[model samples]
Target: MLDWLRFGLGTLLMLGGLFVLVTAVLGQFRFRSALNRIHAAALVDTLGILLMLGGLILLAGWSVVSLKLVLVIAFLWLTSPVSSHLLGKLAVTLTDHPEREMQVDDPSLTRDVKEGD
Candidate 1:
């Protein structure tokens, strides 16, 4: 029946979200640099959140709860990336670690202008 299909899909989505969240946490500890950590955080923000939202939507069916759930998901999707960018920028600006190397190839991080002509 439709109910069984919904339950199965919801369960799968929730499990996938949890898996992504665990990997993100592990990645934070395993990675050497802030940039790498940011990448892992982004994975959690995108995949983990999306999967969880999908699960919630399936569980709620077409109710008002599902509508609110979608709004929350949209807000998170918008804010998470912006917050990550700000945190990464702050880390790069404030930290003074010699061993810290950029793992993500950000053009802004690499682009430098010469002063003298």
Candidate 2:
């Protein structure tokens, strides 16, 4: 009974994770800007990974494997956002845009620059 429940839960989580992953991939192509792409990447970092972790935990049952799975999930959750942020920052720094050049005089960019300087 419990085994059946665990299997069912695991399967559901895996399916959900796959679905979110597919959406994230599609979003990368659908979004217009780098910022939008970053957001889509973040969805994969959080939702997709969480679902995968949940599925793994359910599949592994109560064991060291389950504990390790949780640890992996924790590590991913902790690092993915930071990594994504760094990538986004790098992308913004490396890319050139005429509109953004015009916005250099904008208050927000000026404030950000002053803060960094």
Q: Which model scores highest in TM-score?
A: 1
50-117 per-residue lDDT for model 2 (tens digits): 99889989998889998998898889989999988877666556555524633344667645633562
**Candidate 1 — which residues are off by over 4 angstroms?**
97-100, 103-108, 111-117
Alpha-carbon TM-score of each model against the true structure = 0.82, 0.80
Considering summed lDDT, which 10 consecutive residues are worst modelled in model 1? 108-117
**Which tens-of-lDDT digit does each residue in 8-80 have in candidate 1?**
9999999999999999999999988777798888867688999999998998899999999999889998998
Q: Can you give the lDDT of residue 117 in candidate 1?
A: 15
Could you tell me the TM-score of candidate 2?
0.80
Q: What residue pairs are clashing in model 1? A: none
Candidate 2 root-mean-square deviation in Å: 3.5
